[model samples]
Target: MDFEKLIVWQRSKCLAVDVYRKFARCGDLGFKDQITRSALSVPSNIAEGMERYSDKEKVRFLWIAKASCGELRTQIIIAREIAYIAEPLAEKWITDTRELSKMLCGLINKISD
Candidate 1:
């Protein structure tokens, strides 16, 4: 599979961009920075893992990316608590994370298969 051409990567890149733009105006620099980092990690790790020559390594990194997704999921909830975005937008982020997680799982299974 051309991992670089994966739709998940494309959506993740978009999610990272959305995250940066969403937090860009926030006064809470510390929280914003951490959230952005977590958001960016999702796609970056996926791409990095996919580029590896080994399925074991790729799956390992995908697991790591899945963990990062969990962290981002938590951060998004907290952000919603602090009113970082509206209910609908925060819910959308949650949904996106869930979908991305599923996609990662599917990729890992494909590697295993």
Candidate 2:
């Protein structure tokens, strides 16, 4: 599969945009930067990995992106606890991450298989 064409990449891009949009306008500079960085890492790693010449590299980058997703999950939990993010929005983001992570893993499996 073309990693660039993967739905997870598209969703991760959206997720990054959402993270930036939500936090960029906020007054908390620290949280905003951290969360946005983690979110941006997801798709950025995917794109970087796709530019590689090997499937192993692509999978490695996808795993890196997946790890970024985990970081994003943590940031979401913190943002929720501190009331930086609304519960509904946090829930939806977490749900999206969970689903996308699963699908990305599947895509990796398909590529390796």
Candidate 3:
């Protein structure tokens, strides 16, 4: 199946775009770059894994993507604590990451089967 057609990939892609848009006007370049990169990694890895020839490779990439979601969630919490992000926005981002991570786990299971 095409990665683009996968709901998890689509959700992750949208989350990455939302993260980029939300951080567009922020002044903290270091934090912004880190968070955006982590956010982008989720969907990028998903796509890369989906294109792989073996299920093992695909699972590996999905695990990476899942880890990226955790990284992104941690960054969001730090951003919120440092006042770089609003509480409500951070909460939403954290929720998104949680859901995305769970979806990644489900996908990984399906591929590993």
lDDT of each: 0.91, 0.88, 0.96
> Judged by lDDT against the true structure, how good is candidate 1?
0.91
Q: Count the backbone clashes (under 3 Å) in each candidate.
A: 0, 0, 0
In model 1, the clashing pairs are: none
Per-residue lDDT for 1-113 in model 2, tens only?
56568788899999999998888788988888899999999999988887888889888988998889999999999999999999999999999888778977986787678
- Candidate with top TM-score is 3
**Model 3 pairs whose backbones collide:** none
Give the C-alpha miss distance for residue 105 in model 2, angstroms: 0.6
Ranking by TM-score: 3, 1, 2
Error of 1 at 7 (Å): 1.1
Best by lDDT: 3
TM for candidate 2 is: 0.93
Please identify model 3 stretches exceeding 4 Å from their true place: none
